[model samples]
Target chain A: MFVIYCPYCEEHREEEEFHASGQAHLARPLDPDNCTDKEWGDFLYFRKNPRGLHQELWQHTAGCRKFFNITRDTVSYKILETYKVGESPKVNLEDASHG
Target chain B: MDTVNVSNQYATNSVTERAEFGDSNTPVIASALEHANMKSLAVKTATGLGVTLVELPVTGMLVLRARDDKPALAAALKSSLQLDLPNVLASNVVVDNGKSYCARWIAPDEWLLSCPLQDAFEIEQNIRTAAGASSIAIVNVSGGFTTIMLSGNNANDVLKKSVTYDVHPSHFTVGKVVNTVFSKAQVTMRCLDTNHYEFIVRRSFADYVWLWLQVASAEYGISIEIE
Candidate 1:
């Protein structure tokens, strides 16, 4: 079982306590009323299923009940880091391939 | 013969007639384990029991939520409850005027405060008045949850088998609390002392947890304590 670390709780908890929400850092259109249908549809329905390093939003459902971002390697299923919302991830796709 | 008479009396009262709509002055209150038959289960074991489980009497509980202005919130709590907001994953307990008050950090912006049941309403009003104009939420959740004390020689073993979270003394020291799953049920677990733990569980799940505890502590002899 994966022991995921919750940034808010500042401790590693069992994976059963967490739930993956989706891809993180999705920006809503500034002017939704004037935005094209494609933009709105993309924001609502689309999600990236990246193979390598990916950034995803996760909620510590059983712990603090707070949502945070997790940078993980999808292929290796290894969590690189976990950070709170509105914070930038330290590990990028390029950084994963080299190290 | 006594059981038959009791069943007959219960059958005589229709479902609607059995309901008591008491006035505010004499409002009736019942604990979540009212029907658990805990009193009958309070056993006096001959051998040393490994786990002792007790359902603490109903107490007042409040959920305080504030996104920002923590200092203002802390000040209000201090003024009203004579308690301090605990740090993350920590809990603080204090006794004021013979009434014990506890504040447990539930999240970054949420904390659970509990006190004597009789003083809940007054405490809520005091905190609200103290936090006038501040963006904070104080909800009276006393009836929504219940506290269970699990302690004994093998309490840690029972916890380790029930929850996925680490319950080792080194990792879960005294005063530390965590919201985690216990046998598919959600519970807020707090370490009171060595091999002593408290669980704040939802009222609806009280029966489930009570039964689960019995089964989990079966191998290690379980005893019930009535409050």
Candidate 2:
């Protein structure tokens, strides 16, 4: 099992205590009334199933019960970094692939 | 606009009546494990017992939540409770006038404060008044959970076999508290001493935890103590 770091708890906890919410950083449309159906549908239902580096939202369900972000390599099953809710990840797809 | 008499309604409503005084008709408050029948399993003598398990009597618990006004809340708690807000994964306890008060850090924005059962409502009100104008939430959760003390020589061994988190003394030092999984149920565990540990488990899961402890500590010779 993965030892996931909980940013809020400031400690590494077992993966059994956490739950992976879908993709991270999904912004709602500001002008929903004026937007097209495709945009609204995409916002509601669409999610990226990226093969490489991905940012995902996760909750420490049994521990702190707080949400945070984890940047991980989908293929290698490695977590590159974990950050709090409002913070941004330092690692991106391009930096990881080249380095 | 019509004005409602809230106090009159509350006074006349038997369902919302408060039990301020005890009498022959007033029912005694029982803990969650009161009917678990653990006394039958206790050893008549404590000579060979390796682990001692005791269910603490009813305690007053409050969940304190504050996001942006944490400093204000901390000051308020310091003034009213004479205890500082604990840091991450840590707990603080204070005894004043023979009354013990403890606060365990549950999350970045939440902490659990436990005191004597009879003082819970007064403490909640005191904190609210002291933290006036500060954004905070104090919820009385005394009846929602119970504390279990696991101690003796092989107490750590029983914990190692049950919880998923590392319970080694080197990692789980004194004052450190963790909310982790214990035999499929969630428990907030705290290390009191070398071999002493305290668990706060939900009332609904108290029976399950007690049964699990009995089975896990069977090989080590478990004994129950009534408080």
Candidate 3:
């Protein structure tokens, strides 16, 4: 199991303390009431299943109980970085794809 | 006091009389392990005792939380408990004589303060008063948790088998506290000395944690002491 750093707790804790909540940085439509059913469904259900670097939303369930984003390599299972909610990941898929 | 009803109940039941009136009527205080009755089990299994386990008496615990750091709040806590809020996770403290509190860091904006059970209510009241108009929350959670101290030469060995965190002195030094997984439950643990560590386990899971400890310490030998 991967040990994830909790941005709030400032400690690297075991994966049991965390729950991966899927893709991160998916902003909702400005006016959801005006969106078509298909648009809403796409926003609600679709997620990126990247092979390399992936941005994920995770909650430190057993520790701080704070939600944060992590840039992890799905293949290697290496966590490049973890940032708090409302913060952006410094490591991106584009950089991993190119560099 | 429900003056009329209380008096009526007092007269009707001797149990109620003992519970309600007179200083001679001392209340029976039950520890988290009241049901387990660990003393009998420990007496049966007493051995060389490489790991020492002690369940501290019911302690007063308070959880303090605030989104933002405020100087006024810090000063207020200092004035009330003579404890400096451990802003850093590595600096949590356990003071008995001079300060009478063990301030543990729970999260970025949260802290757990432990004192004598009798002092919990007063400390909670003091923290609320100190917080004033600030957006802060202080809660009395004494009844919800209990403390267990793990010490002796093989204490670290037993901890390694039980937890994922690196308990090596090089990594987790004295005064550091962390909320992490312990067996199947989460415990707020702090290192008092190299071989000594304290765990704050929730009441419901106290028995489970103790059971885990007993099994883990089997190879190292173990002993139990009640407070």
lDDT of 3 by residue, A2-31 (tens): 888888988788898899899999989889
Residue B4, candidate 1: C-alpha displacement in angstroms: 53
Candidate closer to the true structure by lDDT (higher is better), 2 or 3: 2
DockQ of 3: 0.67
Give the 10-residue window scoring lowest on summed lDDT in candidate 1 chain B: B1-10
Candidates in descending lDDT order: 2, 1, 3
Candidate 1: misplaced stretches above 4 Å? B1-27, B43-48
lDDT of each: 0.86, 0.87, 0.80
Could you say which candidate leads in TM-score? 2
Query: How well does model 2 score by local distance difference test?
Result: 0.87
Fnat for candidate 3 (0 to 1): 0.74
- Global local distance difference test of model 1: 0.86
Task: Kindly report which residue pairs in candidate 1 clash with one another.
Answer: none
- Clashing residue pairs found in predicted model 3: none
lDDT of 2 by residue, A1-99 (tens): 889999988889999999999999998899999999999999999999988889999999999999999998899989999999899789876888767
The residue-by-residue lDDT of candidate 3 on B7-111, one tens digit each, is: 111123454356445533232246998887878866776755799988988887888887774566676788887778887565545475764687887777788
DockQ for the candidates, in order: 0.88, 0.91, 0.67
Off by over 4 Å in 2: B1-28, B43-48
